[model samples]
Target: MENAQAVAPKSANSKQNSARRHRFWKQFFTYLYMVILAIIVMYPVLITFITAFKDANVQAFVLDFGGKWTLVNFKNLFTQTLYGSWYLNTMIISVSCMVIQVIVVTLAGYVYSRYRFAGKKFSLMFFIIIQMVPTMAALTAYYVLANMLNALDHYWFLTAIYIGGGIPQNTWLMKGYFDNVPYDLDESAKLDGAGNFKIFWSIVLPLVKPMIAVQALWAFMSPVQDYLMAKFLLTSESHYTVAVGLQTFINNAQNQQVVLFSAGAILVAFPIAALFFYLQRFFVSGLLAGGSKG
Candidate 1:
């Protein structure tokens, strides 16, 4: 009888251990599935990075896992292209747009959140409806309007487009975030003799720093990545952004020089990737905070 009791308890413990092992394997498979998905997403980026370092012979043919490495492609990128001008032009547009958009969006967000003025609902609805309209649909109007203002090929034009395009969603997003902030803070600031701008600048803006950072980073990357609008808008080669500059590389007689193209792509992707990493921690939190209300 003692042996039977001991054996029964051992059997129960073994069954429990087996169940736990089975659960662990199930979780491991789920994680493995996600890893595979991540690899699929990242494979193209890895290939492009590797291709940038490959020698001319390897670039002309299918990629081999074993290939000669060379800095010739990177050298070609610097010598053969107006990379500096493109870099400068893109930086100007991106930075200018980023600053303008952040300011405009923040102010708009604050107003929409705090005010109960007439037409408030209608104005918000209008912005929402405008957001739903595709940017391409307004291409004709934007082109004609910009031309009328003689703004085409001007660096500031891209800034205008970037800020205007981003405003509706950003306004709503920031406004929603502001709504969740305690109104008592605003009251206390006012009682302490803080002006409207002071309260907004000091108290409110500091609290919404995460969302602002995310928006600015996003704004900075837009014109840098945009090929279509920038292509159509900017007629001068010197005025071309990085996206257009990369296209120019392929458009010229050296169409088959894939390594040079790869090098340029890598350069173009670097800054945006850095910006993404810099703001990555705040991005999701900002959006979630913006969306949630008290």
Candidate 2:
């Protein structure tokens, strides 16, 4: 009887240990897969960053993984190029676009979410259809319009494109977020003698702040990284954004500054990477809330 009891408990202990081992391997493999995927995705950027500090030679730019490093890329990027002008131009466009996009998107969202007007459904559907169409499809028309207005070289013209192009999808996103807010809040504000605009400004806006940040980041980043529209619109080298400016390095027939391009790309990436990391919490939550409703 004593032998039988000991044997039964030992078998149960062995089963428990086997189950724990299975679970440990499962979790370990899952994490290992994720780490591998992350490395694959980031490999190019990592290589570019590594190449940025190396000398601008055929071997340094293309062949070697690691070698003697120097700061010449950074020095050349600043001194031999209009990188500062490009940075300033992009900053101006991005800031302006962000401000305009937020206001327009918020207003459209508020009206659609709160008020019912004739053709409201049709208008919203129109916007949804518009979002399905690629912005590049309208590039020719935009170019013609810019030419007619002589706004081809204007940074504000690019700013308008960023705001206008983003409005359809962004307004839809904002509307979805607004739909989640309780109508009771609006009614309560009204009972306190608050007007419609006042309620929207003071009561409603505060609740959707995360979505605002999301839209602001989108607006800013779109113009910052955009090469196509800026390329078509901005005629002068001085007005080039980082994307357009960076192209010059590769396109230069006489002196291809590949290492310098890598350095400049890294500089352009830093602020955007930092901003995304800072606002990531709000960004994910806002995306969830914004996409929750019809």
Candidate 3:
């Protein structure tokens, strides 16, 4: 009986020690994995930042920790290139696309959620089907159409293309989010003598602001990061977007401005990163809620 009592305490102590060691290892590995991933992701950004500030005499491709930092790369970026014009053009397109897309998608989503019309179900299914087709598949058609219309190098024409491509999926996402909102609110507003537009503007719109922010962010980013479409559409240096303009710096062996390219790349991230941080609170909620039903 005494032996059994003593053995019980020993077994419990051993089990407790083993569990503590297991938990310690689990936590240690989890932190190690996170640290490894952080380093991997941050390495390129760190290199770019360092390269952007290095002296003009230093080779841009060569990684050197010891160097004089200078602002000549940025100075050359604006003075030597058409970066100002490209930045303006890109900003115009992005803002125009964001506003127009938000209005169109919000209205379309509302209609699909609240109203029954001819071919409504078929239209919804059609959108889903068409969204499955990758944008690359239609590049040839876009190019031919642009050529035929003489819309090449037109910023508004490029904006229209972006807005058209975005509508189907964005509308679907918006509609799913709208579906989550109770119809009772709409009915109550109607009963209180509110018109359709009033209820939408005053009631439903506020509730779906998160999804709108998400949609706006998506719309804004489309032109900012696009390389292939912008390259194909805009040919004139005067009308180029930042993405296309930045590419010119290293497009050929003769015109390699690697440090300048790094500087431009760093500046390009500011607007996007600022907008993202501002809307980040809404981002996750909007995506999750919009996707919940659909």
Against the true structure, whose lDDT is highest? Answer: 2
Per-residue lDDT tens digits for candidate 1, residues 223-278, read: 88788889878888889898897887667664566677778889888867887988
lDDT of 1 at 6: 88
Model 2: weakest 10-residue lDDT segment is: 58-67
Write the number of the candidate with greater lDDT, choosing between 1 and 3: 3
CA lDDT of each candidate? 0.83, 0.89, 0.88
Candidate 2 residue lDDT tens string, 32-82: 999999988888878888888888774534435657879888888788889
TM-score for each candidate, following the candidate numbering: 0.85, 0.87, 0.93
Ranking by TM-score: 3, 2, 1
Which one is best on TM-score? 3
Q: How well does candidate 2 score on lDDT at residue 135?
A: 88
> Which model is ahead, 2 or 3, in terms of TM-score?
3
How big is the RMSD of model 1? Answer: 3.1
Off by over 4 Å in 2: 1-14, 62-70, 252-255
